[model samples]
Target: MSSGDFSLGDFVQRALPLAILGLALIGAPLLIFEPEGLPRMRALSKELAQVKAENVELTRDVAHLRAEVLDLKDNPTAVERIARGKLGLVRKSEVVFQFGKGR
Candidate 1:
């Protein structure tokens, strides 16, 4: 083949690398900077971690509430304590006292 006689194979071999390089240059920045790319993925991962932590905390709170509900259901003393503490309730013939704040 003569030097000037460029065939399809020659064009393909020469242009393929340039095409690949051009695509890389254009795509690399898009991958890094695009809204749906690495940055968004990282943000989503952080949000997922935060959501998972919140879920765990909520799960703990739910368990605590369930246990408290069970305790209030099964334990008569718990009910009495809440009633007396929150409601200032007293039984019949119970004496009551009041005091002002002291200096």
Candidate 2:
């Protein structure tokens, strides 16, 4: 081994750090600035959170509607209440009164 001659081991130790550093310098900007990078990931995360919240709200609405349907199906008074309030219905024996509009 001569002092003036460079060995393969010495060459690798010198070149490896420069190679890794060069790759990092080139790759960091691509990760930050590319369309499919950090920005896309953040956008998708926000969309997922919104969708999950909507799903929770819809689930609650479905539960409430199911209970109302069950009540209407089993309770006659509930049915009559809805019919009277929404359809302007009355019993057959009920009397009616009419008044003229006053100016």
Candidate 3:
């Protein structure tokens, strides 16, 4: 209540919050508007989304492969179909007519 009677505890109590607030105000702009700060955050966010999409695509691919594996394991016809289609296999009595050879 008296002039020039400031106590140490009162000065510290008042100055501490001001110091913290000053640091926050100064640090916020340095982190938000600085070229390497906000841009890096944005770039990382974009990369995270892209990676998530790729992970989804990979998960779908893995599911398709797993289904194919199940088919190949449980079904004999599936293996025969694949062999015939991909390897150009035919039954012993089947005829293969090549209409577009060396054209």
Clashing pairs in 1: none
- What is the TM-score (0 to 1) of candidate 2? 0.64
Per-residue lDDT of 8-103 in model 2, one digit per residue for the tens?
999999999999999999999998879999899999999999999999999999999999999999999999999989998989998878899998
Candidate 1 structure, TM-score to reference: 0.67
Candidate 2 residue 51 Cα shift, in angstroms, is 1.3
Q: What CA RMSD would you report for each candidate?
A: 4.0, 3.9, 3.1
Poorest 10 consecutive residues of model 1 by lDDT?
1-10
**By lDDT: ranked, best first:** 1, 2, 3
Give the residue spans of candidate 3 off by over 4 A: 1-3, 7-9, 91-103
Q: Write the per-residue lDDT of candidate 1 for residues 1-103, one digit (tens) a residue.
A: 7799879998999999999999999999988898989889899999999999999999999999999999999999999999999999998899988999999
lDDT of 3 by residue, 1-103 (tens): 6877999999999999999999999999998978889998999999999999999999999999999999999999999899899998988999988877675
Candidate 1 regions off by >4 Å?
A: 1-25
- Judging by TM-score against the true structure, name the best candidate: 3
- Badly placed stretches (over 4 Å) of model 2 are 1-25, 98-102
